[model samples]
Target: MGGRGRAYTIVALCLALLAAGVVAGVEWARRWEGSVTLLGNWTGGDEDRFRREVLEPFEREHRIRVVYQGSSAESQVLAADVEAGTPPDVVVMPGPGELAAYAGQGRLEPLDGLFDPDHYDPMWAPEVAGAVHWVPVKADLKSMVWHPGALPEAEVARIARDPGEWCLALESGATSGWPGTDWVEDVLLQQAGWETYQKWATGRLPWTDGAVRKAWTTWGALVGAGDRQRVQRALLANYADPWGGSDPACVKERLEHQASFVRSGAHWMAVRGRYAHAKAVIPGARRDATAWEVAGDLAAMLRDTPGARALIRHLADPGTAQLGFTANRAVPTATYDADPMTGRVDATLRARGTMRCWDASDAMPPAMRDAFHQAALRFLAAPDELPQRLAVLEEMRARHRDAAWLPTVCGNG
Candidate 1:
């Protein structure tokens, strides 16, 4: 070979060796001292709590970094990232249906043995299409009516029956009208039992079905829907604010049909918020309305990187169940006893044989869930339009009959 040709070959081999060495170094760092990116819909104090209670410990223990991205528009952001081929390493979001859809598209990595099954109920972290997909990290309980000040169950019961006697707040930004949906869901679960509620949630039960429509009518009557001035005020009021959007001076005398998370509010504390099972006073409630409507923040892996797997294991650790409520019965009871209200919520979450159905909209396909939220707002504005609203929802459901829905939405069955 000529001298110039030999020199060119040597240069090419040197470049190849340099590239290979660089790739090896990067891979080694990633396998040992890597970072995982996470996305979730927790912002402000919620994000802070998650960081303090979960991320910090995982980082310290695993010596891995967690790059968390918290946003109220978590669904939209995750969808865009997935389409752009830049999805996070892990995603922590409420509503398993969303995760199930990704799992169906083959966008998610099968999380088969990353966490111990003994820490959670099979339903809390169920398999999708024969492969384990997600694990629940936190929980929220519905089927509760909060009242200010201590009152006998009978007194709370009597007040629950009158729409005029309740404090209602319906607005939530971009997801306004969800509070009404919660009311309808708890009412249905209290009236129809888990079997019917589960069917309705998974789109097997038509929205116009007897029980479904009856639940709508029940909520309409309970909340005085279509009282325009009152309805408008509620439609503009924010659900998370203190006083259920009523005057603070009079909040102590009102009742709010909300979830367990709101127990920490100042108004609730000032008046000593107390809860009663919605079944106790809901109109036409079945004698045994044992199913509780609940929400959960479920963790799923989108990238099969080693860092992501380590993060998932840390999340499933029993000690990480320090979130206000845990589905993991193995978590110590003291973890929840920080306050009486929280302790009670945690106890209900851990109660054996107590069924927990997913929050209806939270368990639905994103499109269907968004439509349901709008339907609730419209129903509040025009209670007379329920028949038309039910027809619309049923039509939408029929179109998406084969959508990826969670195999089992309720636990402890």
Candidate 2:
């Protein structure tokens, strides 16, 4: 009885201790106020990078569990969640206009105390109704023309004049035609300058105004509006298609008008190419034009719990913004500035006192924004129908005219 009973008692004691430890750990995790859900549009490499560089560190430092959901149809998914009354605690989207709409509806919590206003300018964190609703986490320089190598200014000008030499892809699935919106935005900025561009973007100017009409016609002329084959190819092509390929025809194409994110494409040409400011090659660009079009991924809070607010504060740090390349001047740039190609693009974006405007299509209300994209596609398909298309856009503009527009888009500094 002594030896056998002693061995069994020791084994039972050890098993009881282990079970007690497991119970304690589970209870601690359940009671901790350190769990938040995040919804975003990032996927693939970008999502991996954000998890590694941004979310993981925050989770470790604050002992928070971040449940992330990445989707290409982020807007639709967000809408569904909001309608179902189960929206995530935080969301990072590429469109501020949509955020503004949400904020106006009181769906977003104010970041006024959570984020340092000094870290971001008005354009990056515009306020509405006395509350800062969103902040930029990533930015890209748009309205850029990427070419394999340096081309003379004269050659660039001539290429812009010839429709056959231009390369474009309008396919982005559900967001198909947004690339076209970028072109028109760039042309408006170049030809009409920033002030006029802002007016058109913010609904102050009519879509049929002469300057706006000129921008549309100018884009049409450059992309070969009446040619079915060219338009068809553009319609079928993905935005990243021009970045790389073994096809001689694609390789020989001299110019690609796209955003800075095109640098991430797998295509050999984009990897090896450099970009110039779009104004350099834009026909009818103002001689003194210094405007640049830009876009960014923005972060906003939906549920302002202490853990969620802490996450926003972490993201607001300049160091956090610098973890990725951004157009924000407040973020450090030594890494990007070292490369000549990116440096040039970076310089243009960070230029002191120069006009830097956010992408207009991304700034308008959803209805008008969708109309702008569809209008670009329709106009490209039939240039003759432009007047009718402009009229349709005017109606959309009137419908959404009451929507809030950012007070100022171009920063003085």
Candidate 3:
């Protein structure tokens, strides 16, 4: 071979080797010290707590750098990122309903090999295997009743029988009318039981069904007229803030059915514990009352880098449960017995209990969720317009056939 040819070959080999070394070095650095970006709906104080108690610990233990970005309305931000093709590595949201869109679009990776969900609590009813799209990092039991110690079961019973004693916060900023929806879900459980609850939530049962019509009618009568004027007056008379101020007088006047986190608010006087109180007030408290509720959080994966994997692993670890609670995120699927961190009673409200997982709204698809929220808000504003409101909801559901067609993990076959 000629000298010049030999020299050219050596140079080519050297360049190729250098390029391979650079790629290997970058991958190694990512494994040991690269940064993981995370996004969440928790901003300000909530965000700081998560970093201090959750993210910081993970970084220290794994020796990986973390870039945590938080916002009060992260859903909008997430949509924008997904559109721009620059999403974060990991995301933590309130429920799976929202994440289903991303997963169905092939943006989210299946979490089967990521964690052993069985090791977690069993309150998640659809079961972790069926809910393979997302893993719940935290949860707050809903379907609870709140009232001051001054108010007794008898008082609540009277209020439940009389519409006048009903009080609702029709004014929750941006997410207005959520309180009303809470009432609807609780009432559904009381009137029809879990089987009915699943059917209605998954869109299997029409809104005009006898059971549904009764629920809507009952809610309408609370603020409507005819012979229920006295009841409506009583409900309005006690209408005040459910939270804040020296006392949650509204909760005291009647019964406040809300999520377990209400205990942290200033107005919360007392509860039987997280799950018990919710069960006690619902119909069939003796038969089906439970110390748990269907609950779970949506963990969004923004960027698919190595750093993100570390964050997911750390947060999914059972050891991190306490840290999440301190951050105001209830541990998802927590057994109702005794939470060592918060010292709250954690036990099934019923001797033979069933813990149904998944929030009704979060399980619905995008169009249906928006329609449900809007329809509820309109109905609350004008109780007399219930027929029109129901029509709108039905029409919206019809328009979004895709959402209505989603598979149900647990529902009527």
Candidate 4:
């Protein structure tokens, strides 16, 4: 009697344990079925807005979970992940330049097959579709000027005539030279027009051209007769407090040229607002050609898993546009969307016409971008050595032989 009873009890206990294990495994599998991993640069408030406006809705509707990993050094993290064979399903890089590197390494999934190419603005779709590297998520106008406080019409004319008030931030860290590059592009647009801007941007035009040289001279003069030493000090000092509001360094660069994203906080500090404040800056000041210009923060897919495809779908929709614009995110756009507070300001902005996709530095290759950043620092410090600086840029461009050219959105004509 003792042997039979003990044997039956052991068998029953074993069966119960197996059943429990199977149930636990099933629940775990269910939890991860629609879940996916996303890795990229957004962090803090930006991450929160994305989760609130975009990811939460997406999860609710599709029954998917997004494991978002945010970081400041996203590119480095992405590179390391790829090397370690543990990559994310989707990534929203700052620009197409980095996307090109991933695409070349065969780390990205071609998106043309997954989404409708036409749904995106054609300007953004250019060379990105069939090539299948990246698609634009949202854009901001880069070729814009910001001024703090208020300006009288007479003052606007005065500033335009006197380049001394035209201030620029030379402390953009890994992308420091970009502010300089924006200056060069704006100068070119004012002098040579869009066609020439493209030539210089695409490297079809020589870096040593007279216009290019002139750009250096103009920018160098703006920085005053300082060598890289002085400018570097300023940049380092400026960045020491780059968290926003107002620093004498940034404020002194009075007319900071940057994307629209910084408008609210920066402008709130009364450092600057849009340059086209018709009533404030120039009562009767008319636009040169187009009323507006644009640039974008683009998202690209890293791996081609089904999870990645779902993210692509989420980002491409018009509804997702609000994610980048939420109060928490604070990334601005040049597109005319009416705000009850801003009223007809956006409408007025659109009426003037638009200049399209002219972010010069972002359009260049990654290595060249690094070179461009350092060179701008050098150029600011050594205005007289313009030729030498440009030559260096030319060499850098040559080294990145495969730097892909993205199409211009507004200035093709």
Q: lDDT at 167 for candidate 2?
A: 82
Lowest lDDT block of 10, candidate 3: 345-354
lDDT of 2 by residue, 307-367 (tens): 7898888877766735445655667768586678777776766666767888998988778
- Across residues 122-201, which tens digit of lDDT does each residue of candidate 4 receive? 45555642476666665555555555547654555457544455554567545666666666656665555566777776
lDDT of 3 by residue, 200-309 (tens): 77677776677766666665554333334333333333223554445432533445556666556555544432223444544433354332344556565645667776
Q: How accurate is candidate 4 locally (lDDT)?
A: 0.61
Sequence-dependent TM-score of model 1: 0.88
Write one digit per residue (lDDT tens) for candidate 1, span 1-413. 99999999999999999999999987865563778999998999988998998898887778798999998888889999998999999999887878888888888898878877766666677778678888888888899988766678789888776777777777777777788899888888889888989888888889999999999998988878988867776777778873643353124337888888888887888778788889987888888547788888999999999999999888887877366678877788888787787887887777877788889898888778888999999998898989999999999998888888776778773
* Residue 79, candidate 1: alpha-carbon lDDT: 91
Show model 2 residue runs off by greater than 4 Å.
Answer: 1-33, 243-249, 268-271, 321-323, 327-330
Best model per TM-score: 2
For all predicted structures, in order, the TM-scores are: 0.88, 0.89, 0.74, 0.77
Alpha-carbon local distance difference test for all models:
0.83, 0.81, 0.58, 0.61
- How many angstroms is residue 14 displaced in model 4 relative to the true structure, after the best TM-score fit? 31
Candidate 4 minimal-lDDT segment of 10 residues: 277-286
Candidate structures ordered by TM-score, highest first: 2, 1, 4, 3
**What's the count of clashing pairs in each model shown?**
0, 1, 15, 13
Model 3 has an lDDT value of: 0.58
